[model samples]
Target: MTFFQILAVVLTATAFFAYLNYRFLRLPMVIGVMVLALATSLIVIGLDGFGLSLADGAARLIAEIDFDDTLLHAMLGPLLFAGALFVNLDDLLAQKWTILLFATVGVALSILLVGLMLFHLAGALGLDIPWTWCLVFGALISPTDPIAVLGILRKLGVSKRLETKFTGESLFNDGVGVVAFLILLEIVAGGDAGAIHVASLFVVEVGGGVALGLVLGLAVYWLLKRVDNYQVEILLSLALITGGYAVSEMLHLSAPIFAVVSGLLIGNVGRRYAMSEHSREHLDTFWELVDETLNALLFVLIGVEVLVLNYPTGALPLGVSAIVVVLLARFVGIGFLVGLLRARRRFSPHSVTILTWGGLRGGISVALALSLPPNPWRDYLVTITYIVVSFSIIAQGLTIGPLIARANADSSNPTSD
Candidate 1:
């Protein structure tokens, strides 16, 4: 009944399913646990719909779970930080240009395209939503999920250079995507603010976010150097996720960016100075455990939280339409941008293909959909977003390995990493 007790029960159940999947199923841990949880919850719901014995108790219990808030608020910070921490700092820095363009420019294109397409489609369906609302959806969904992609990428045996580009872009892209979402919100909420002011606001949100992240990262790194206790150091990094996220959010800065900067600083800049040999080993083990544990909880939350959602039956068409528009926008954005990059010497055609397939949507999309204001259509939006996110994370995340293998097969030498 109490909050902490509920969390303990949820986490215990999630871990049990995750272990089962990891040992026997050989499925990607997140997808496996999520699918299992989803099926089980649906079974309970189906029984309730038919008035089966005990359905009431089961359905009520599942309905108490909140998928949206759990992912967006509690799990996302640590998940993104863990993903960013594992990335090779050198490779990320090398393709910094491509990452910036794809993350920043590519996101803008996807948002504008999806918004306009959805706006028109909604009108045809006799739905009258403001363009601002559609743009809000676009911002929320534009970020390619770093946690999901990197999980697959770790299993991807692509060239190191190519892998770095994909991993780096995916990590920063989420940060860029979230910033885009906030910008769209400002436009919706900023009734009296002019265009020039909005542009200025964008700069401050992004620039200020990056600057704040760097400063916080350095400050943490300096504090870390004076300590040699691995347990204590790991706790500091954990604090960076929980405390750092809380502070950044309070200051209206980007929590996702702040976590990434702090993680990367410890992983790269402070790797030598801040950690002793014993501390390094413990730190790595500590975070890997954190990463996997949170990942398990995230997928389980994604699956069971659907039970609590209140999707409207009225806007199913609009919600479905948004899914189609986003899929098309992704194809166009990835195809055009990556193609243009390849043509101008950014990456090879093969490399571009893998990156395109690698744009996996997961927790962030659902979180954004959940973050939406409750309107008549919000229910439809959340349900549809969940559908799309489930497909992307499970279907795409599962198959990306084969794509990477095929793409890398022709090369004489490749990393089996």
Candidate 2:
């Protein structure tokens, strides 16, 4: 399919599925669309089982979508920027230590735990996967997807403090996760990834991305201050997202981080001092639509992604096991940090439980898995990643609201606990 054809089909399907969701499903928009799309894919698969050719066509269409490139390269920048934009920087700063530990050390811990557990689990399940490949899987899966988290948070009225923790960690950790995935992938692919080299990679990617983001953000803020036109200011923000992301990629920096940093600045400092009231309002409305539209399409893409996945022998069982693996790692990672922070700070009842379950994995993990080099274990990794993500989005995404409500209730009435 040509680019426009692909766009048309995606938009048409998104609109149709969204209508169905609005009409009957009444689930969250992104989750509802995904569920419907997955159901459609399954229906196609069922028809193919009876000697029909629908599966072939469906797979072909899905294959053409290029899930990894379409998401990580094209859609991610704007999505991340939109998410980070409206985040209250003051709240985020208050949880700086928590976000820092969760984004960096917490992610590292989850990667280690998940990798080790999966390596052993794969062995027990008779899958001959190496430890490094398992670590690569961990690297991809450890970070909670910001796109998914932010979308769900919009619907669930969680506390500002907790929401900040969730949003802040998700926004930053994906960049850290991507960097780790690259380092491990290098070692797995026979690159000379020495300790020094690995550290240098992190420094260059993370540091450079942060530096570039601040520079671009400040530049945009300075320019927006001089401009009184809302249209011009909006266009400049768009330029910052598109141009800054591309430049970050060309320089081998972390584009995800670049988007987050730039968005935070533009939404906070720029909104306060740089942009006029009319421009701020227009900018917020524009980015909110961008976030909602892209999120819907992204989930729809994820739903149909099931059609093209190659499930190897024993992959089903292994994938089921991986869901447990990821959850346990998430729990431990968040629990450890929450435990430490409680000594110095206050937390809601079941804060750890909410944080663990709230860590929804979405397109980023699947995109990273799909981007893996074609090797013996790539299919296994991809299948498991899909399974884990599917469960995260559909199961955990649906129930997080109740969990927060319960936590809120308990916090309000201590005697109830």
Candidate 3:
């Protein structure tokens, strides 16, 4: 199929499912689209079982599009930028320590815990996954997807403080998580880089990306400061996102990190000092639409992707066990961060639980899993990642509304450290 043909099919599917969701399912738009697509995929599979060729055709169509390249190289930069663009700079700064801990140390902790648990779990299940590959899974799944988390949180009307923490951590941790994933992937590829070398690579990728974003952001801010035309300003912002991301990739820097930093700068600094009222409104509307459209399509793609994944027969139990492992690892990671922060600041009751359950994995995890090199365990990893992401987005996502409500009620009586 041609690119436009594929695009047409995806958009058509997205729209149909979205309407179905709006009319009957009443689930969150992204989640609803995914659920419907997944159902359609299963139907296709069942038809194939009865000697129809629909499943093969569906899988072939999905396989025509490279999931990893589309997401990691193209969609992710803009998506991350859009999410970061709306974050309130002041609120994010206020929660800097908490965000930092969660995005950095907290992510590392989750990776470690999840990797260890999965390694042992695989052994118990007689799966032949190596410890390193288990860590690869950890790296991919550790970060809460900013797109998924922000989308759900926007609908929940949660506390600004809690919302900020969730949004801020997700935006930043996504970049950090990708960096961790790359590093682990390198080790798995038998790269002979030492500990110090790996540390240096991290600094260069992360630090260089931040530096590049700051430069691009300030340059755009300078231009926007002198302009009053909302159209031109909007165009300039587009250039900043697309050009900045492309340049970061060319320079071998972290495109995700660069996008986030640039987004924060533009969303906060540019909005305040650079853009006029008219310009700000237009820019916000444009990016919000972009975020929504991309998110819907991405989730639909994720759901349909199951059609292409090779799910081994004996891997079902391991995949199910992985879901529990991921949730427990999330709880432990968030609990530790919240507990430590409680030393210096009070937190709402059940903050840990809310954060844990609210950490919805989405397309990024799927993309990372898809990007894995050809290995004995690649298919198994992909299967496990898809199952975990589906549950995280659907099951945990559907239930988080009540968790947020409970957290809000408990916030009034926050316990002091």
Residue-level error in angstroms, candidate 1, position 36: 0.7
Query: Clashing pairs in model 1?
Result: 311-379
lDDT of 2 by residue, 220-319 (tens): 9999999899899989999999999999999999999999999999999998998778888998999999999999999999999989999899999999
Residue 138, candidate 1: C-alpha displacement in angstroms? 0.9
**What is candidate 3's lDDT per residue for 1-417, written digit by digit as tens?**
999999999999999999999999988888899999999999999887788889888999999989999999889988999988988889888889999999999999999999999999998888878999999999999979645555566676666787888888888888999999999999989985698989998999999999999999999999999999999998998899899999998998989999999999999899999988888999999999999899999999999998998988657788888999999999998898888888886687777887888888999999999999898999999999999999999899888887676666666643121
By TM-score: ranked, best first: 2, 3, 1
Measured against the true structure, the TM-scores of the candidates, in listed sequence, are: 0.90, 0.96, 0.96
Q: Total clashing residue pairs per candidate?
A: 1, 0, 0
Q: Clashing pairs in model 2? A: none
Clashing pairs in 3: none
Best by lDDT: 2
- Model 2, position 264, has a per-residue lDDT of 95
Model 1 CA deviation exceeding 4 Å by range? 53-66, 314-321, 343-346, 409-417
Candidate 2 accuracy as TM-score: 0.96
Kindly report the root-mean-square deviation of model 1 from the true structure over all alpha carbons. Answer: 2.7
lDDT score of residue 25 within candidate 2: 94
